[model samples]
Target: MSDTNAIGLHQGSASDLAAKLNELLANYQIFYMNVRGYHWNVKGPNFFELHEKFEEFYTDLLVKVDEVAERILTLGHKPVHAYSDYTTLSRIQEDKDVHDGEACVRGVLSGFQTLIEFQREILSVASDADDEGTASQISDYIREQEKTVWMLGAYLG
Candidate 1:
């Protein structure tokens, strides 16, 4: 609640795990932004289809970003915000000028897959730590990411 350093409580005491969760949240934000990029910039023969699908993905991811960061705060860790923080914490890389339609699709798909994997890993860690709330939060997100990935991949085939 206070910006006086949201660390050293619950799993935060386990700074390594807290840092890992922070990284995942940062990656989710980057992934969310990149999805927005795909939604805004995707154009080609499949414009109508990819456009709508990407919009759905970004919208879903936008919601999940809040959910993920809130879970971190609820776990007693500050939600990562600064770009410098994100660049250091996030495993995801944003796409700036992706032009190829398939490349866009591939990039998004890969991002979603990576997100799902990270969420699952974090959930597992949460479970191991007996952090049921965080585990449940990450579990819900993993489901959302999987569904989004499925929908995005379906468009390609």
Candidate 2:
């Protein structure tokens, strides 16, 4: 007989969901580090505000990273914890020494967009598998990230 997890999800289904969750987690990890770099290195007249904003964004991303990892574990899979795994799995590229405030904001927007798109994909997979927990988490992330993109766009304009 085939095995199913505690949530009645088949091992294959759980494996797929866990893989996607790991990818999402990887992206968040890189994005968080990028934002931290932005916070630490942002320059120009808008320094104070942009620094504070980047810190806020990174802090939020950090929380979501942990949540995604936990979600993967809940699905009976190990979360990828190494930086090398993040670099390989994440579509978001590593950013370094991005001092210009506008450039940093642009990077943030781009990362947010990538994450939003990625999570939407995960949302569909989780929904199909009846993983309401993963689906709901991704949905909440999408809603919040959409609002963040709007806000960031406004700031850019």
Candidate 3:
């Protein structure tokens, strides 16, 4: 536990939140890597559009990855960044091979939706724990990922 708890934040076992945060961080890492892969491998008549979009998503993911890790650290937990941790903790599975352009968008949309749902659950747990900071962070993450999902879904259509 941290030496000082934020106001309205109860002194509860951070074990559960810590575990969830680690899982979220791991998922984010996998998602980011996959986005990067799409950015590099995307090819088709829509190449310019899809490739640029993938780059934008990857940039957002990079920022989000840092934000989540920092939030974990703020809670007095060590953020998981290693490949081993990501592989074990992440639920997001990587594509073995690049698919069609539309399929790539679908894949990313699936990932974003999965992440949004997981983060929403974590936020609920944080709220129940009376950890306002963590809850707020989860809300922010959910909002951002939800927007990403919408954009990706739109691209798929």
Candidate 4:
């Protein structure tokens, strides 16, 4: 039998893509919870603004988390679902009790930086594997987040 997966991609390449996507999912899960905490705990003069923005961020992250998990399934692999797995695999650690607006923004910026850099690596691997779907998805995320990073940096300045 041929070595291709159900989706017609080479099994080895699809497995590699799924592995990277799972890592991304873990990071997204951690980041999502962090933003949710930021939304709920933000205080001070900019509380309203930061709270609203954090809600937006976490909402988007939730969608991305689902999409990444589904993509892993499409690749014929299981996405890591347990909170234990997320905590173990994610590089973006939990940010607890960050009530300061600036601190929360900084935390978000750091998470975006981590995700963008990691996505770039995944993009390279996806490109090498000729996995255009994964590459395109990651490319869109990178493009959107580069702009966000710039805006967040401006906010901090």
Whose lDDT is greatest here? Answer: 4
Q: Residue 115 deviation, candidate 2, in Å? A: 0.2
The residue ranges of model 4 lying beyond 4 angstroms of the native Cα positions read: none
1 or 2, greater by TM-score: 2
The residue-by-residue lDDT of candidate 1 on 3-114, one tens digit each, is 2233323433344456767888788788878877877887788878778877877787777778767766666557778888887777889788875678889989899788
How many times do residue backbones clash in model 1?
A: 0
TM-score of each: 0.83, 0.97, 0.89, 0.98
Task: Report how far off residue 143 is in candidate 1 (Å).
Answer: 2.3
lDDT of 2: 0.94
Q: Which one wins by TM-score: 3 or 4?
A: 4
Stretches of candidate 3 above 4 Å error?
Answer: 1-12
**Model 2 C-alpha lDDT per residue in residues 1-157, reported as the tens digit of each score:** 7689977898998999999999998899999999999999999999999999899999999999889999998998999999999999999999987899999999999999999999999999998998899999999999999999999999989
lDDT scores for all predictions? 0.74, 0.94, 0.82, 0.95
**46-143 per-residue lDDT for model 3 (tens digits):** 88888988888889888988988887777767898798889889999976478468877887898889898898889889988878888888898788
Residue 125's lDDT within candidate 2 is 97
lDDT tens digits by residue: candidate 4, 48-144? 8899999999999999999999999998999999999999989899999788889999999999999999999999999999988899999999999
**Residue 30 deviation, candidate 4, in Å?**
0.2
